[model samples]
Target: MFRATETFATHAVANQPEPADPPDPWADDPALRGRLAAQGGDAQTPAALGAAIRDGDAWALGEAARRHPPELRLWDRAGRRLDEVAFHPAWHALMAMGLEAGYAARPWDGRPGGHVAHAAMVYLLTQAEPGVCCPMTMTYAAVPALRADPALAALWVPRLTAAAYDPALAPVAEKRAATMGMAMTEKQGGSDVRANTTRAERDGEDWRLTGHKWFCSAPMSDGFLTLAQAPGGLTCFVVPRWLPDGTRNAIRLQRLKDKCGNRANASAEIEYERAWAQRLGEEGQGVRTILGMVHHTRLDTAMAPAGLMRAALREALWWCEGRRAFGRRLIDQPLMRRVLADLCLDWEGALALGLRVAAAFDRGEQAFARIGVALAKFLANKRCMTVMAEAMEALGGMGYVEDTPMPMLYREAPLNGIWEGSGNVIVLDVLRTLSRVPEAREALEAEWDAGAGDPPYDAALAAFRDRWPGPPDEGDARLWAAQAAALLTASVLARTAPAPVAEGYARARLADCPPVPGALTGLAEGAILARLGGAGPAGESE
Candidate 1:
């Protein structure tokens, strides 16, 4: 030993290879191509874009994985009030790819499955990167609200639909494309936009705004849709970074929020004094004007958690299959298999229902889509946290490290439930809409009709209605929303998935107490893993 200078335990348990990024995110999706075509999308272009999003070249995913988050520059080198946000090159590259891929413009394209196609594209892209999706979602959501004023719509919609991503803090007129942000929260109240104290004054047909926003998201966007109190009451305005004359407006930057997740994008707090603005719609109707935009954004919020679950589950299963433990592969262990199977069941059901609502947007089911989005957001977003924790457990200690994407995914899992509307806020929203919008109940009824073929699902729906009674109220909104989402998802699976796969989902998921041993015997792990890579359960591809 002294002669050879041998080393001991030099290669203790060599670390296994982490799962690689899919060659094509679009193609790996078990559901995207058919979902798009079923909704009438010409899937050729989006399918092609999938390979780019998979980011085999490493440029896009590399940028997103960089150490630094976006930074804020309050002043320029010459001591001017630049109020700019400086981003790493990775953020810019990822954003540019998404804009060019048409993630923000599909709904406005007016093609068959326009909304469905858009939804599918965003679902695929966000799995690799979530923060960049914020600005894109805002740009997409702002369309309907801006259209409330025909002149404003004519001015902004074309630019928003443009395929270029210009990050420069310059005049909108000078850019080939634009993005949008929203500022609705303040110190006094969070979701209560009615409590806003920002003041607006009339200056000819234009207006001036002066107040503070506790949370002004996507601060670098070219324009913002904000709310302020006017002579008429809470009013909506389009506040731009520059005046028509090309001078920087008075909307000042306070500080960027130090958030736990979503570090790739900048969220800020800011104040303004006489920021020149254009009124969006009738005064005193701010809530009414922005309601349409909220619906769309909620749909985006719901899509995000479902996408995250699919990606995380794939990684968990891949690790289980590759790693040996207790004299056998980890996936061969019964307990590990049970946890992963449960995850797959939830992921498929959530994806199926979420896409159906997205299709409803395409079909103009405004009444059904509105309430459906809330139900899904409340339930699916909550499930994301549970699933992330379970997946991390399946990987043991290594999954908790930042080297893998699991830590980032876990940090982001709870955010969707808190965004747009917190869990309780969503429950109340379900109640508020049930009392106001007749179609809220109709959405549930639609699911019942779709799933009558399965006895268990039909029985579950009956029990759900009995528990919820007529319209749900503040007291039982959580119960109502939970059962409604389960019923809807079960119905979806029963109608479209194979009988064994669908029934397994319902038996394990809808039970009063989840059975101790649940296995989806007919649903193969390879088929579920392929969903994360690009094929459906039926093995079709783009």
Candidate 2:
């Protein structure tokens, strides 16, 4: 109970959602409700996935961890057997799901859906698979605007989309917990889009690309999304892996990075000269298209740390409940209980926050989506690492042992923080959003207001201004920046609203109260609880 007490301490202090209507526990949280609604009609996908994950029908999630565990033990043991397996079942299901639920079903339905379909595919694979290679193929899909170009879409989107599920074109490299794709990282520029010296010049009726890609995951991919510089600017093109003669393209493998994880996926650094390629979008638009894919890809990368953390926490709880210490179950010990409680509360906060970002995408709020995704990914990844370490500590030596799953989870969580974008990069993104986007900042403020019971805007504005006295000549940007900072600061304050009382209890072991640490942490410092008489287990416990 000491551990649970300590854990609950954090949760109690952070804050909780306000009192809500009887039917909807999430009613006070528009963000949560909106997100739950956005991921199709059901927010049960994760739960459902958990239920049937082991089944062949469940897609690659279960197999994903199986594909790459703490060590490459399984792959090294049965690499050939796994590779022979068909295209990742997850990709198939995801593409189908995107077409059904994730499709951008708005004004620009077709193009957006294609983008989404591609995004969903990339997201699942990066989150699920292990390897040092790229997460998505940088598939022609990565060049969506190019793929969907009026001229290119007519020729490419259909062909590439169809080829996506083509088993012949899609090959799985056993299980290495790395990003898998066709092209490899160049020795000179891995992610530096501008530094790519690959050249794709127009040749009669054909565009020929010549350059070296150093970190190709599946160099054997039917085609590679290659970046090259043209006279106008850098451009992206899709180059076939093989020619009509059924021989590999003029692609020469340099070497594969001896990476730490995702070893099962083959990553080859390769050089291609006079490679037959097709330009997707107009020259110089490569960066835009690639960056667009990146915007969506970040969502996928974000899922990885969260998923890893989820798995680790589940393991910790299971161990705590069953493991015995000093004649009592670990969970029965007050200190152990505190740890578990705090872990769970933090987990819930991270989950809700990440889902909120996902909801932004579902809501067609791209700008919000970008900021939310960055924030969620950054925070979740950071938390997961900390959680994994704490979970390990809670278990003592057993946690560090390879026999336990915690170590692997511990290793994986940090990787997601670095992937897609680093933590620092993400924080900068948050700062940039605060600096540039007034509308988003304002909308965020409205969110804070609704949760805490709105303060008079005029009064609040005056109060806000008074708190920050500074020079006038710094202009509107500076003033608004201050306002944005204040608004964000206020949002944090509003996280905990109406406090839970004995009379308001609703359920056993759970109250209609906030369970996440962030939900009540702030209030825990000084709030008083009233033990008003009430009915039910919720009140009875208090």
Candidate 3:
């Protein structure tokens, strides 16, 4: 006692930022609140869910889940086939919270603004944990695709929509609730579903699927909406994990993919050895049927990036506010302020654009929703990488350290862009949509026209039309898509965001501002930064 305590002095921690406790994601996020209200979504559910995530141990749970990735248990110790994936308790806890809060059920709950509310949930849940989003999104998206078969929809929609989480290894009928996954891509054909070779044979009332799925995400779901070649070309089917007799299905888990990210959720390569399946839609209509699911999932993919950007920026801002350098708070430094403020434009534009597309979904504007979501997904996801990188840099060394959430956010940033559709796929789809669906182009133009007063936006719109005239050559497709998406984002911001914020985006993005973050000249720094903490004219805390 005389020697050790006195001789060894431990330095006290100084000028370190305390952990940013989870704010009410619903209440603190004025952009989310404002957009939800503007889009006519019911704020009651989102508010409640946000509070639950904030007040509960969601952050800790998220961290624990990320730390402990899911493990594949293909067989039991007794040498029997199990085909189960084991997740940490934290994963199940987060999944339970999401399902209980209607993450998968809201849109089909017969409520107004169902889609909008569902989109909001996607944004909110993504902030807490991005990995768990894969299964829930598939579950949410499956409802519409399943509706292609009224019988299948009737049997499965209730379980899919039930506000409960049942992780039992049992038949769907035996569980109180169920989650859904999708297995569409084969090794030979990733985005080209028409090139699928998985064969489905008639086995009485049900079909038997026999092929390999290269990527099967959330492998433990109760059922999966899969695509296979049937007697009449490719078709969609519902493949259950367990047979009605409480026996395992013929689906074989080859192995889990060693993915670079989304560690908490399991993605697998599997073989469908005559797995029992029910035909979901008419044979040969697989692409058309599955497009329904793909479309909805794209909406989530679009919104998730917005949530990730928000989460990263919040961390950076907190660090700047509490940490000091050169005898001044980091937030008080002019250069730091410029960087953070410029970053805000991206996060704000992304949130606004994504929600606007969501609102289109809510209003049943299929023409606009189709094109709008693609634009939002493409633009927001691209901006997400930039925002995440800049925000990480703002935190200096701590951002790169695993001790903080930045690395996780950085890892997740590229996933949404790759999922649903990669960048090239999205751009080609936009061209296809605009070419085949004239109404989509008209709707898009109408949307842009609504924000015509901004000079920069107006000039950008004019230049886009003149440059394209009739869908620029495929070589220029990406450039066209990027310009169109940026203009669309600026248009949406003009109508929905505060004047200064909208003007800043138009000047920085639509005009001649450099592509890099913080390379801006005339951004209203005060107005944009004020929105970060939910305290500006347009972003008043609810």
Best prediction by lDDT? 3
Superposition TM-score, candidate 1 onto the true structure: 0.90
TM-score list, all predictions: 0.90, 0.63, 0.92
lDDT of 3: 0.88
lDDT of each: 0.79, 0.48, 0.88
**Cα displacement (Å) at residue 482, model 2:** 17
Stretches off by above 4 angstroms in model 2 are: 1-51, 57-143, 146-148, 154-165, 169-185, 189-191, 217-220, 243-247, 429-440, 447-450, 453-542
Question: Clashes in model 1: which pairs?
Answer: 27-534, 28-533, 28-534, 29-534, 30-535, 30-536
Per-residue alpha-carbon lDDT of model 3 for 279-333, expressed as tens digits?
Answer: 9888989889989999999999999999999999999999999999999999999
Question: What residue runs in model 3 are displaced by over 4 Å at the alpha carbon?
Answer: 1-10, 513-542
lDDT (10s digit) by residue, model 1, range 1-542: 12433346664333364445455767776565654554465575567567777654322463364467878888988899988788887788788887887887878887767676677766776677888888999998899999999988887888898877878767777777899999889999889999999999999989999999999889999999999999999999999988878899998998999989888888999887899999999999998998878888888888888878977887898888889888888998999998898887777766767777888898888878888888878778877888889998888998998877788889889888888898888888888888899776876687667887677776777787676668755555666677778777788777666666689878877775222112123445556667688465465443
Cα lDDT for residue 471, candidate 1: 78
Ranking by TM-score: 3, 1, 2
Name the better of 1 and 2 by lDDT. 1
